[model samples]
Target chain A: MNQPIAHASLAPATPFRTAADARRAIRSGAWTGHTVGLAPANVQGNLMILPADLAGDFLRFCQANPKPCPLLGVSEPGSRRLPALGLDLDLATDAPGYRVFEHGELTAEVPDLEAIWRDDFVTFVIGCSFSFEEALLAAGVPLRHVAEGRNVAMYTTAIPTTAAGPFHGPLVVSMRPMKAADAIRAIQITGRLPAVHGAPVHIGDPSLIGIADIAAPDFGDPVAILPDEMPVFWACGVTPQAVAMAAKPALCVTHAPGLMLITDLLNRDLAFV
Target chain B: MNQPIAHASLAPATPFRTAADARRAIRSGAWTGHTVGLAPANVQGNLMILPADLAGDFLRFCQANPKPCPLLGVSEPGSRRLPALGLDLDLATDAPGYRVFEHGELTAEVPDLEAIWRDDFVTFVIGCSFSFEEALLAAGVPLRHVAEGRNVAMYTTAIPTTAAGPFHGPLVVSMRPMKAADAIRAIQITGRLPAVHGAPVHIGDPSLIGIADIAAPDFGDPVAILPDEMPVFWACGVTPQAVAMAAKPALCVTHAPGLMLITDLLNRDLAFV
Candidate 1:
């Protein structure tokens, strides 16, 4: 059983105001946990590393399924740095925690990718929901899961991803219950930020998208939905991970859930409108 | 006992391509029916005419409740022309039909305001949902009522309007049943045209907004809501009329429902984004 390693002493005492500060702290081993509150003003990304041979199919998959796999930045094969995301970002070390997968199964969880960094590995930084979540909070839309300190309930939907080569699977969506008004507002707010999952894929009835159970999510803890609220679902970053695992890639690496790679891109800059 | 007088010979043989053309047809007695398909590319407005004594409060009410009463153009007291909407636009005779109200009660419906026009009457042209509906249809969002040749279903919600002087009443909303996905797309599409009601006020679970029965609408015709569809609601142009009626003004005039005042402004130009 590969469990995520947590370093108690590595947590930062103060939040980072800039992406560079957060990256430096992570690179120096001072911060080795989730990057949620570390850099409040920067974009955070879901990180995935695959072999050079599999990168093309994955890229095509992302193009075909933009809602689930919105590309933020991609690094050249074997490159440790992603200059577009951050000036001094180290792809191998900037992320707080990394998960190593072998033949679609979790093999090890480490603080950094230093031990098994592959020369043929290509780094893909995908957009995360944090940016839009921050926007939603700023707009006064409340998130029950965030308030309760629980992971957003995620479920595997029957909605199929546009297939590309061997990269294909059901789209996994993260659910947040909201009042009808707030849900409508959330749709508009997230619609402007297409880089971060854009708008919701489905709203209201769970059965419409093949989710047989609302209280039981396949991943993440289920938050109690109020009687006055309707469940709103967004295309999740987990889709690529789920699809990659299903493809049974020989070797794969991903940022652990909740732990992300902080980038220099401002969340506002990602809003196309 | 007065009712709208429709002249079969007054209906235009060919659809007008320009606002000027449509206004000319209406002005001349060549069009005396609904202005639904006339000047399809131009903006059409919900007409409201009130004496100078009530105009100020009505303006304030519109400002407070922009979703239901988006002001597109206004004419000064005693002025028959709204040059901003169109140089040739006549508030008195440009609309195909006008409804006269006295003490909040429907007194008479006429082809034009010529016989009842007063020097102190102030005309307010409000943005209509037709613009956003066209945009939605262009974007491939299907409208069931339009296909069935029936009026959009409307209801009076428990949502109260912000009162201004003597203007106050329950907020009236138009309901459109749509698949969750199409409803999401409608929100984004309408969000761009703020002048025309903007995004929907509520979505899913009509009872949450105090709509007890979705099938029995307070105004307009009710359409079938499919089992897989959710009822999406928007603040209706009928709201101002409802509010004004509740206020019981001495005299009020409005364009007959669906018989709008066509303007020179292109619908696309009204999109804020």
Candidate 2:
């Protein structure tokens, strides 16, 4: 799938007061595309919108499968404002892009969800990998995908998620190649942030987790796995989308992959003891 | 050296009362042997005594090398009580066994220090592995050393210790083998207890930490390392004693290998945010 499209760099004449100002610019049709490296150091969220009926099951699924679907905030039926994440936030337009799925089928990829917003829609703001990635980078952990400028490779593992009502599927995991020592440190650092898919699900041999082919993942782009490097897997935010699609919900909507809903909450504020 | 000589356990009828009662038994000719399975939940510590002149440097040494020498409580020169660790604690007689060193040379191993107590001596209580081991065992993490009835293999590694004052030497580490998943869990569990040797310093290939041979460790008996297991190494408290001996002070003292000083402080009290 094509990314939401990278946002245009600042036009050199834009005025900015806070994170909400940046979001306003993006929402005003002045900004378009992926939000990578833009307004970073803020907690970005993976978006999922579903009918109010399935909201309870999806919430349970997220609670059961915290490593993959760390819940940051959940909106009431038909609500748009996630004031906890942002003040001027409108899920329909604040995000850079959207993927509309009908009957678990990709129907369209667009810049905004305004035309498709339904009164019965309940929005879920799941934590993205950006916070942990920021932490890893701060700790000097070399991220192969970031260096190579590609999406982190993700795999559908044989590890089954705890079935919550109709929401059930194999856990999806994103892989990053790191040295063993760094992998250990990464586990400790990420463990501190349970809100962001805390700690790693698996490290070392991918075969142990039933990944038949590490070279070819089921999703995302594959990067080099060096001789001394181990493929450390984290429960990815994508797992919820995969689980939702597999269950064949009549209608579902999600953020275009990588085009997260940037929020005002600093990543550091999400730490748990 | 013959172990604490478990004569008490051979025909034991006495149920130990308090930590002080247990220490007094070990002090007076009532008991001598492994403290393990004795005071189940109490905090145990590795003991080190240095001359006042070199105590400042050793303090810096501990501050610099926190992983190996997580200093829990320190006593002033000529003072035997560490009120932070326990009530009415007398360092000279609290430990079951004491090793005396003269200018880096082993002079004697005794049950108590009453015969050699000096006015200028300063005592330090370093966090030991027993605290975390109890936690791991409580969590059902199989410990190969205790299972096989052997001492956890310890090695002097090429990983250098941060030196302060006259104490500078290679880091000494203790090895325990566990499956990859368990190793990750152990890291997370121990990482919460920094007062004890927090987390594994190095894992997987023992050679990464300069262990020439995994089968033969420099100290402690070697346990089985299963093929499915990774040898996780923790910064051992022995590193300071080894460094202290190497530094060769006029007179130094430490608790014998495994006979640690049991304190009234509970292990759970050591967990810090």
- True-structure lDDT of candidate 2: 0.81
lDDT of 2 by residue, A108-199 (tens): 98888888889989999998787888889889998988777677888888899999988998888889998777988998999889999998
After superposition, candidate 1 runs with Cα above 4 Å error: A1-14, B1-14
**Candidate achieving the largest DockQ:** 1
- Using lDDT as the measure, the top candidate is 1
Clash count per candidate:
1, 3
Provide the TM-score for each candidate, comma-separated: 0.95, 0.91
Model 1 DockQ, alpha carbons vs. true complex: 0.90
Candidate 1 positional error at B243, Å = 1.1
Q: Give per-residue CA lDDT, model 1, range B201-256, as digits (tens).
A: 99988888899999998877779999999999999888888888778889999888
